[model samples]
Target chain A: MAEPILQVRGLSTYFFADEGVVRAVDGASFDLYPGRTLGIVGESGCGKSVTARSILRIVERPGRIVGGEILLRRHSGQVVDLVTLPSDGSAMRQIRGGEIGLVFQEPMSSLSAFHTVGVQLIEAIRLHSPLSKKAARARAIELLALVGIPRPAHRIDAYSFELSGGLRQRVMVALALAAEPHVLIADEPTTALDVTTQAQILELIARLQRERDLAVILITHDMGVIAEMADDVVVMYLGREVEKGPVDAIFHAPRHPYTQSLLRSIPSVLAEPRARLATISGSIPHPLARPAGCPFHPRCPDAMPGRCDADVPVEVSFADNHVTACHLYTEPVA
Target chain B: MTTPVLEVPVLEVRGLRKHFPIRQGLLGRVTGQIRAVDDVSFSIAHGETLSLVGESGCGKTTTSRCILRAIAPTSGKILFRDEHGDAIDVAGLDRKGLRPLRRRMQMIFQDPFSSLNPRMTIAEIIGEPLLVQGMRDTRERETRVADLLRLVRLPAAYLNRFPHAFSGGQRQRIGIARALALNPSLIVADEPVSALDVSVQAQIVNLMLDLQDQLGLTYLFVAHDLSVVKHVSHRVAVMYAGRIVETAPTKQLFTSPKHPYTEALLSAVPVPDPRRRAHRIVLEGDVADPSNPPPGCHFHPRCKYATEQCRTEVPALTEIEPGHAVSCLRAAELSLRGVASGS
Candidate 1:
């Protein structure tokens, strides 16, 4: 395998609140190879988004990266630890959009309604390159065209509010790719889109990844999406990675009970009509009062009373790349 | 699945149309009509779930709202069967006349968070419907609320707790219990589980299925998620630009769709299995604007199988197979692909 462009090891991001600290991204680890897509799959509050924010050094106020190393290998082959740098510092700012671009879920909220799409695109373009306003505007049009926005020249002048959801998302993709970043982090990029629109967006992302050889971190709650787009899958539960493996291995031979139950529980168009879906027993626990040991123990059908509740299980390797953090797979301590 | 004996449909909608006037200028002059629900028709048999599947602004929500009388239809009939087995045209009913029928057909909203009142306890929320129906006795309401809670598989002890105390799934259960409070024969669920997590979604879907089996409830399920629609529906109607393009049994819709739009929709749904990553039919453009849709077939602009005739002439929905209807001009000739059946 080619060398990983970005390696995240034992990443831990916490949110300090009045009540208590939230372990939003607790000890997550993954490798992102150029031209390969890594999917972070999890339900809401599972820390998938926080992990992305942590990597970008954009964890909002009240939140901080407490531990872990985000190792990024630059074009010169010099590796830098992203966590050690000040989030607002020049170097971090340069790397934020210069090397790694982000696409958020809600384009409406993330985008400035006051400005036209061209302004935002040109600003992003000029930040990463030494281009004048006219040249940057030209580059912005090219970016929009690259992301498949019809009549990019005319559409560039329209405000974000004037664009449809699909078109706005296309603009977001255009902005993200404006910097020619090596890695793209799209957090729930298509969740807000309709099915047909989602298909189009997914196809666009896949095509862009192929064209640019981009290392992509696609975060979503939809397993269907992971199956369709991800080369590797990381399944999270309550901020912790419960399972990680090749997409085929993770889908066909899942190790973690949560992953298994999740795959079974999702209503599939391919499934037998009117068949009752197998359900995971309980809902996700509140972030403040996260359970001890395994977070998913309360809902997991295969949970061991003492092992899964008293002590956290370490990741157990089952195959070349297949691994699961569960008491079911871990050896019992004497 | 054993087929139920044929009976008079619990709800029948014929040529339903809902058009909102697009007023322009300072005088607020009526310029044109945005046909939100245009000439929609379907029937939901007793204990059957009929889903209206479409994208946002495709008029699925408008159709459901029109059926529930939450919004008045511009024209056509909404025939709802009463407990006495007489089909009452709810669309023609005056506000007073529709009052009794309202209790017989209730609506379940999409967002459980906002659908529920935060200040009210579960008991109060569930008992609100019973109270409106003239259940004056507090003790009786409490007992009925308790029963409703149990019916949705929630603990009776949580009756005193407010909506904030529950999860999205639990709040949805509460919403379902409230909708069931009146013992309505027909339920219009508008994207009920779409707001929930995948795991929580299954539990709610199963609960709804179990409730339908137990209570013989008829469901007019409106949602955009094709997978959930496939799982829950007995029959499905595919809508585009305020009109239904196709209607078929759930199995037929999934295995062998006749309409190009339905085929694209079924193919668009991402299959969970990575091994089955097939080439998807990416629709070229956005859904047609309801106010200014294309002259003939609304879907012709994006449909791959569109021909010259499809662009110039309107196609009326015609039945090619029994229990399966499609509106495309080349419905008979087009061998559109569908998702292969079985998990």
Candidate 2:
């Protein structure tokens, strides 16, 4: 493995609430190398989005990163700890959009409804670069073209409401690239689009990631998207990493019970016509009232009686790059 | 798989059209009609799931609303036969006459939060249909509401809670329970599981399928999720520019799609396998505005194999197989070249 561009070690984020402190992200860790895409897959309330927000220090009020080390590789070849960096400091602000660009789930909501797509892109460019208004506008147009938006010269001036969902998302990608960031964090960018549009967007993202050598942290519930784009996969459940490995390894042989259950639950077109879909019976446990031992023990079909319900499982190694937190693959099993 | 338990089609729509008058200027005069849903026709068999799928603004929702009579259709024939086997014209029903028709068909809205009244408790929300239909006695209503909640997998104790207390999936379940309160035979679910997580989506789709099996209900399932629609639907209807481009059995539609639009849609779905790489038919260009749709085939502007004939003459839907129908000038000549080439 190459040297990682970003390293998240023992990351834990919590929300201070009236009822109790909610451990929204608990001891999650991953590494992102340059020019590679790492996908974080989970259900809605599994803290995947929260984990992404914590990386940028955009975890809103009531939510705070309790413990962790976020190491980022600087352009000068220096590794800086993002956690220890002062909040709202100049260096951190420079990294927020300048070094690490974020593309939110809904382009319509993230982009200003009132402003034209070009105006927003220009604004982002001006924030990161010392370009004049005209230069920034040209840069914005260039970024739009870079993201595969055809006829950017004409479509750039259109308002958000006027553009299609796919076009708007392309503009969001353009804005993300306006500052020439090394890393892009896309949170369910194609979830709001149709299948045809989604495929186009995914292909665009993959092509751009290669051309720019940009490291990407993609957060999505769609496994298909993860499979198509991600080189490495991280399965998050109830704010913790259940499995992390190469996408091929994880898909071919998921060691964790939670990961297996999730994969089985998905209805695949490749599967037999009459094959019954497997469903993990039970909603994701609320963050406030999470399970004691294994967060997935309550729903695990192959859970050990005392082992899965009595203690937390450590990360057991399957291969050089594969790791899983499941009692089924503990030291005793080996 | 066992033989399909085929039943007579309970609802048939012919040449359905819905046009919203576009108001212009300070005088508020109607300038032109926004042709949201134009000349779309399909039939729903008893206990069968018919999915209407297309991108946003393709008139799938408008078609559903027209069938529900929530918004009156501009012109069409909505022939529905009730449980008594009596044919009724749903489009001609007024507010007073529509009351009885409402008991025969119900609508499950997309957004659970907005569709449900915030002020009403779960019980009140679910029981509203019963109350509106003049179901007397508070005791009987409470029991029926409890049953509905249990049917939707919600605990009976949650009857007193409000919509804000439930998660998106739970809220959608509540919406389903409310739609089923009146024992309607036909349920028009407009993207019921679109807002849910992928994992939650399968659970809801399975639940709907199970409910259909138990109750023998017909569903007009409208959604953009091809995977979910292909899973839950018995027959699939592919819509483009407010018109159905193709209608076929679920398997046939996925494997042997006739229309270029249908072929493009199926090819776009990424197979969830890291080892296998599937070809994606990238549709370039935006969806045309329905108000001023293309002269002939609405999809010609973006179609890869579009010819001069497709640009001049509008193709009429014709049966290519026993039950499969497609609206394409070159249905006989076109071939889907990818994974969905043949059955």
Candidate with maximal TM-score: 1
In model 1, the fraction of reference contacts reproduced equals 0.89
Clashes of each: 0, 0
lDDT of 2 by residue, B1-343 (tens): 2324546578999899999988989999998988899998888878888899998889999999898899999999898888788778898889998877888898887787688899999999999889989998899999999999888899998999999888777888999999999999899999888777666777788888888888887899998877777668888898998999999888888777899988888778777778866767888877878988899898999999899999989999899998899999999988775243212
Q: For residues B263-332, could you state the per-residue lDDT of candidate 1 as single tens digits?
A: 8988889989899997899999898999999989999999888889989899999999999999989988
Query: Which numbered prediction scores highest in lDDT against the true structure?
Result: 1
Q: Looking only at chain A, give the TM-score of model 1 against the true structure.
A: 0.97
**Model 2 clashing-pair count:** 0
Model 2: per-residue lDDT, tens digit, A281-324?
77777788888889999888898888888898888876558999
Best by DockQ: 1
Q: i-RMS values of the candidates, in order?
A: 0.9, 3.0
The TM-scores that each candidate's chain B achieves against the reference are 0.98, 0.94
Instruction: Provide the lDDT at B303 for model 2.
Output: 92
lDDT (CA) per prediction:
0.92, 0.86
Worst 10 residues of 2 chain B by lDDT: B334-343
- Score candidate 2 by DockQ: 0.47
lDDT of 1 at A70: 98
